[model samples]
Target: MLYDEFNSYKNFVGADVFKNKATEKTDILKNLNPAFPVREYQKEALGRFYYYVEEYHQKQKPIHLMFNMATGSGKTLIMVANLLYFYQKGYRNFIFLLALATLSKIEGGGQI
Candidate 1:
């Protein structure tokens, strides 16, 4: 059946296939070095984002995530933390983009 076919592709760890399990309520905040106060709103936003990311991965689909945060809501910290979490999970490649008024501002980070 289709279910059996999908199960065959899931990764197993200690007899528990990774696909069969949901992501735990991780202590990602605690693991953050130089941690700062995380407001309740921030926690709710990050939790939803992480859930969607995990769901996409588990379903073997490409995932795209966006965070809509107001100014000074710790967007950078959340981004860095997400990247670090993924990196620790064996993802090596990443791209971070910043928007400017025009295309003229687009350049490699190596250049000033």
Candidate 2:
């Protein structure tokens, strides 16, 4: 899942089901916000997340993914990237940004 590299989802789903739609969406986002600045790790992470989504769809099982970063480590950006990627896969009403009691307290409060 390199930035300039493209991933093919030809295994789990059909040969051309998504057709690199995730890459297309990411490219579109990069073009639209050339200055928005998505880090390399973010791209790889979101790409892996998208891969898991494909796995979930093919297996009909729940898959859990997590992103751990220090405070203000651009995790919010990762979260948003995740949401947008899956949204393109036709998933609506995503639940995001939940944490356990201690972690929630560390954040002071979670909103949005």
Candidate 3:
């Protein structure tokens, strides 16, 4: 249902509405470190995030988004890219939270 809702809205507005609008200075790919090449799917995820943020602003709603991805699917890489994006947009403060379960796994010598 949730995904259907997203698709419905995206389809109504046309898929091109979700494209990245950032210029070179604030572009996520340009700002990313050369050592960490982002995959196409990862870039698509970021574009969706950016699109929703603009939608929220236009609708005068709070900005909220979540990345639903499987483990080892480069979620951390996306977060890093998001940070760079915001940093370029003049955001200087950020708070990053990690789940205790993940921390415990790492502490127990398990693969994250």
Each candidate structure's count of clashing pairs: 0, 0, 0
Best by lDDT: 3
lDDT per residue, candidate 2, 1-112, as tens digits? 3222224444555544343434545543464334346665555555556655654344334655567667756676567666666676788998764554543543335322
Q: What tens digits encode model 3's per-residue C-alpha lDDT throughout 1-112?
A: 4456657876898764444432322466766666556766676677677656554444334555679999867786688777887786899999877664663554334322
Instruction: Please list the C-alpha lDDT of all candidates, in the order they appear.
Output: 0.53, 0.54, 0.63
Query: Where in model 1 is the C-alpha error above 4 Å?
Result: 1-27, 33-35, 56-60, 99-112
* Model 3 alpha-carbon miss at residue 1, Å: 5.3
Greater TM-score among 2 and 3 belongs to: 3
TM values, all candidates: 0.53, 0.50, 0.63
Model 2 residue runs over 4 Å out of place are 1-28, 31-35, 55-60, 98-112
Best by TM-score: 3
Candidates sorted on TM-score, descending: 3, 1, 2
Output the lDDT of residue 41, model 1.
Answer: 57
